[model samples]
Target: MRGRPAALLLAALLTTPAGAATLPSASILSGTCCPGTLWTPDSRSLLFLDGPPARASTGIYSVPAGGGAVTRRFSSVAFYSPDLRWAVRPGTGDATTLERLADGRRFTLPTRGADVVWSSSEARVAYARSDTTGNFDRRTTRVFVANVFGAPRQVATVYGGGPTAWLSEQTLLMSGKASASARDRTLFALNVQTGARTTLRSALGFRSVASSPDGKRVVYTVAFDSAARNGLWLQSTAGGAPRELNAFGSYRWRDARKLLLIPLQTDGGPHVLRQYDVGTGAWTTPGDLGDQVRQGDWNVSPDGTRLSYLSARDGNVRVLRLP
Candidate 1:
């Protein structure tokens, strides 16, 4: 589970046809490229964040499918963009701002803090505002939506500590606290236009949620034990029982047929990038990229032909391509 032997297995997988064709060798960015989140809109470009710690100094960067220069789109703290063109960078002090990459335009929006999310069309941004008094017991959090440069519109008031995902142009998928103990979290689908909401999942204890490429399915991880053992599950958007997928790792749908999963060893170390066949429910062991790199980030190219991920070798974070 540790050291050279594990690395060798990874290398063997890389030499195989399926591993090599899915991920191609590529160049690394100038600095450490730790992918915070990955987004693939097409086959040509991949967008992700490279930085240290959440809520710290970080920015968004994009690299080509073949891998070359990592373009720094914006500076300071920012969140992911829907269309990958604009990022919401909350300013210091009294006002919050949205930064547009098209023309480098920065506009002030009415928001106390930025938990910004882009509309499905990437034409608007939504965020949450919270008021916490010194008492710590009295607090209020509300969600709002606004055009990229227009005024803010109130959506709904939600409790603290939950994640949100856009299901479609008119609906939002949110994980809300369902109990006072905070042990249970419920998934809710809210319609932005009608203000109607419905529950998707309840008491699931899931930590991460990712929507499929077609927006018809969702993949998420939930802890199964107190020792931090976890499992991955897939649920349909139509709201039925979740089907558990046995592989242990964070995964993303490469297309409608395949999933890019990063396996976790029993010793709590990451193994390699594994491709899971959604149709057959089988895992293809990942190949290695020789001694200079170990493990690729589970990110597929926008076109679905190649997989690119951050590789750490010789004490550096290098961008490695597998194809």
Candidate 2:
């Protein structure tokens, strides 16, 4: 009987999917120094905000992906451009400062403590100012865009949600309702120059609305909307029917076409890494972390070859090589 039980266990292990093998992962930063770490533009290092007791002063710090000594990269932290060319710093008042990292030259925008979303070139930005009082989903929001050192120009207005992501230098993706009392919200695109608008999807509300790296496609979640409308969906920026993704949980774009997901299976077990290829319309289990990700604090690398997450097991940032 004992021999039979051992043989059955071995068979079960052998029957497991090879692609879902446990990925190799290691802690890159420990001692509880990270919870909001972001990857560098080049994906070579991770950036985080830290201050006194842990260091000399408050600033942004960096650590190599392969693990190394921590170093300060910026004296102050703000919404930095992806190209690392400019820093958008919001003040206590209406004026937000925009500074070029290469030179000390700066300009100010009346953003009222809201951060501006930068274009890929880091030349132009879009931000919103909303009415202070009303229902959370009914507040009037006015959207504006401006060049690095130019006057602000109002472009669009939204009721509930506002500008979510910039699809291109001239285009942006956003969500809101047409009327204050409408239950359905819309995810749409706006042309900054021509003032053209294209509606993509409608639901009770949307969450985790993420644009692809190339800004060609978007993936978002619509939950508690309806049985048919609830789940993850993907759509083209040029406008098309929304394609529902079968799986759910936390996801990040591995590249322009590939999306990596960690299912919301909190069974005190390992977290599996599954991938969906938009071009091929296929789903494959890449691998699984031997532990759970802490607070969804995980992201795919810029090159789409690796992933990093704050470990729920040890409270540290860990790097994993994808299969």
Which lDDT tens digits does candidate 2 get at residues 42-149? Answer: 888888888888889999999998889999999977878887788888887799999998987999999998868888888889999998898879998899999889
Scored by Cα lDDT, where does model 2 land?
Answer: 0.86
Candidate 1: segments with Cα more than 4 A from true spot: 1-24, 30-82, 103-107, 131-140, 179-183, 224-230, 266-270, 279-282, 286-298, 315-323
Question: TM per model?
Answer: 0.71, 0.93
- The prediction achieving the highest TM-score against the true structure is 2
lDDT of 1 by residue, 1-323 (tens): 22347457455433334443223355544345454436456556666666555324567666665557667555654664656577665667647767777798878875666567766688766677666563222234567777767887887765543336677777777765633345456667778789988776665366668777666677777675332224567777668877777556556677767777765433323345667776786867555444223453446655566655555544333345443
Instruction: Find the 10 residues in a row with the least total lDDT in model 1.
Output: 15-24
Q: Clash number for every model?
A: 19, 0
User: Which 10 consecutive positions of candidate 2 have the poorest summed lDDT?
Assistant: 9-18
Q: What is the lDDT of candidate 1?
A: 0.60
